[model samples]
Target: MVSEPSDAAVPGATVARLPYYLRALRDLAAQGVTTTSSSELAERSGVSSAQLRKDLSYLGSFGTRGVGYDVESLASYITVALGLETEHRLAIVGIGNLGHALANYSGYEARGFQVAALLDASPEVVGTRVAGHVVEHVDDLAAVISRDDVSMVVLATPAHVAQDVADRVVGAGVREILNFAPLALQVPDDVVVRSVDVGGELQILAFHAAARAAAL
Candidate 1:
C-alpha cells in the first residue's frame, strides 16, 4: 500500500470519487481479478477512463505502463486516502425509523464505521434496544459520545430537533456528521457535515426521467 503524502492536498471532488474507485477495486478483487486497467476500473465505477485517471493522479502515480494497477494495492491506497484505514465509531441520535435503519446497516463495518451508540429523546426509546445497542437518552449524549469514543454522529431526528441534536453533538467534540434530516444545519466551519436528502435525490431522478420521456 502506498502512503499518502501528508502535505498532498486532494480536492473535494477527487475525494468524493475515491470511494467509487475503492468499491470498484474491491469488486474486482472479489471476482479473483488481481489487476485492472484504468478503463476497466473506470467502467466499473461509472466514470470515463480519462476522468478516473485524472482523479487518481492526485494520489500520485501507481499503475504500470503495460501491466495496469494491482487491485488490492489500489484499494488499500484509496482506503488510506479516504481516512478509512482506521475504524470510526458513530453515535446515531433519534431511534426513529430512519435512525433504526442506519444502526442496522451492515455495510458500515465494511466501510470502516461502527455504530457505537444510539440515543433518542423519547422516554420509550431510551431504554429500548435497537441493533443490539441499548438506546441511551439524548440527555446523556455528551457522556455517551465520550465513553464510546464516537468520532462521528448521524443525525436522523426530525427537522425541528435535528439542529439542537447537532449542536449537542458538536459541543461533545465530534467533528464529522452525516445528517439525514431534511433541513440544513448551521455548524461551525471546522465541523464537516454531509447531508443526505432522500426526497431531494428522488426529485432529481424524477426530473431526469421526465426529460428522457419528453425527448422520446
Candidate 2:
C-alpha cells in the first residue's frame, strides 16, 4: 500500500521523475536491454545524464561504477519507490462523460490500479453497463467502498457536486482522491487531493492567446 507521505520527504522533482524513469526502464526491459548506462536512461526519459544520476542517487547508489545500472534492479527499485508493487484499489464516482470514459479506460489496470466500482447519482444511468461492469447508484458508495476496500476515489463529478462528493469520499475513509472537476475541493489536511481540470487548462491557453494579441 502507498502509505501517506512519510516523515522522510523525497524531493518533489525527484518524485516526479521516478515515474518517467520507471516507464523508460520498462520499455528498455521489454526491448531485451538488460543493462543501461546513465546516459542511455537519461535519453529515454528526456532528462540530462547528470540529473538522472542525481535523481537515482536519492534512492541510494544502485548503479555500478563500471558496468552502469542493471535494468531489472533499477526497475524494481523505482517500482518500490513509487509504490507500484502493490495493487491499489480505486473507484470511479459521477459516471458522467469523463467518468464513463475513465471507467472504460483500460490503462488504469496496467498501472496497478483496479477499478473496483462505477458510481453515479442518477437512477436512469445507474445499473447501465460501463466498461465491463454496470454503474451503481451513488447511494451505494459507502457500501461499495467497504465491500471493495477502495483506498482511492476518482472524483469525476460536476464542479457543483465535487466538494460534497469529496467530503463523502473522505468520510468513507479514502485517503487519496483524484479530482477531475473544474473547481478546487477542500478536504482534510491528511487527505491528499490531486486535481486535473481539462477546461481550466484550455482557459489558461485562451488567456495566453489573448495576452499575445494585446502584446501585438
Candidate 3:
C-alpha cells in the first residue's frame, strides 16, 4: 500500500465504498459533467445523501456550499484517501477458474493493487503464468509471500481449503484476506478477512424479500 497518509483511515465501511464513489465520479467526468450535488452523487452510489456527504467529509473538504463539488477533484480526493494513489502488492491462491479470472482481471490494478504472485496446490497448475506472475506450488506460499513482501492475500480456493489457506497466509505474515469461499475462517484478530459468498448474500436477500412481502 502507498505510504498511508495520516488521513487515510476512513471508517471500514467508508473505505469499502470510496472506490464506488470514485468510479461514479469518473463516469460523470467522462460524460462531460464537471460538477455534481451530493444528491446526484448519492443516486450514483445508491447511498443516502447524508451518508455520502459524511463519507466525503472524512476524506477532506471536498464540496463547496451551493456549488457542490467538481467531479474530477472529488474522484482524486477519494482515490488518495483510499490509499490508491500508490501501488500495493497482492498474492493470489487457488488457480482454478475463479482464481484465473481474478489474475486476468484488471480492476484491482486500476485501483493500485498489483497481483504480485499466484499459487495453487495442484502440481498440474504449478509452473503456469497468469497475469504475468508465474504460478507456484501452494507449498511455496510462505517463501513467495515473504519474498514478495505482500500484505494482502486473495483466497479463491474451495470452501474446505479456505481456512487452511488463510491459516497459512496468517502464519506467513499476511495482514488482510479477501476470501471468495463460502466458509468462515480462523485467523488472528489482527488479520482482517473480507468474505464474498455469493450464495450466502443471495440467501440473505431472499429472506429479507420474503419478510418484506409478508409485511406488505
Candidate 4:
C-alpha cells in the first residue's frame, strides 16, 4: 500500500529523477517482479544506486533492508509523489504537424493526463478533427480551457507565437506548460514551463557522435 506523501521539500533534481524511477518500477511490475533493490532500480533508471536511494529519501522511508523495496508499493508511492494520483486535463495549442502528433499520442491517458482540447490559429485547421478532438480556434483558448477545466497546456506553436500563447494559457489559470517551440518562454514565477527542443536535442546528439568519431 502507498503511504501518505511527505510534506518535505524535494529538490528539483530529485523530482526529475522520480519519473525515471517510477518507470523502472512499473516495468518491473509488468514483468511479474515484486521486489527490487536500489542498485537494480538505479541500473534500469540510468542512475547510481546511491543517487537513487538519496532521491527516494526525500519521499520518506521505503523498502526493507534485506528483501528490498516492494515493487507495487514503491510505484504507488512515486505515483503519489509525482502528483499523478489525479488526472490532469491538457490543452494542446497549435495543430501544426508537431501539435497534431502530440494530440494523437496514446500514452497521455495512461500517465494520468488527458488531452482535452486542441487549438490552432489557422482558420483552415481550427475546425478540423484530429485525434478525436475537433480543433478549436486559438482565439477561444481561454474559453476552451475554462470549459474543459484544463490544468496543463502543451504549446506546439512556432517560436514567434509561443510566448503569446503561453501568456494566454497562464492568464487562463493553467500553471503547467509543455513547450515544443524552439524559444524559451517567460512565464510567471508560479508557472512551470518544460521546453522540449527536439532540434536542439538532435544537435546535442550529433555533437556527441562527432566527438566519439574524432576520438576513434
Q: In angstroms, give how far residue 131 of model 1 lies from its true place.
A: 0.7
Clashing pairs in 2: none
Segments in model 4 whose C-alpha atoms lie over 4 Å from true places: 1-7
Residue-level lDDT tens digits of model 1 in 9-118? 88898888889999999999999999899899999999999999888878877788899998999888889888899999999998898988898998998999999999
Order of models, best lDDT first: 4, 1, 2, 3
Candidate 4 per-residue lDDT, tens place, 1-216, comes to 334456889999999999899999999999999999889999999999999988888888887888899999999888988899999999999899998789989999888999999999898998899999999999999999999999999999989999999999999999999999999999999999898999999999999999999999
lDDT of 3 by residue, 16-119 (tens): 87878988898898899999999999999889999997887676666778888888877777777777788889999999999999999978866788899999
Highest lDDT against the true fold, candidate:
4
TM-score, one value per model: 0.95, 0.88, 0.87, 0.95
**Which lDDT value does model 3 have at 147?**
94
Off by over 4 Å in 1: 1-8
What TM-score quantifies how close candidate 2 is to the native fold?
0.88
Q: Estimate, for each residue in 18-98, the C-alpha lDDT of model 2 and write its tens digit.
A: 989998999999999999999999999999999997777677767677888899988887888888899899899988889
Model 4: how far is 197 from its true place, Å? 0.6
What's the CA RMSD for each of the models? 1.6, 3.8, 3.7, 1.5
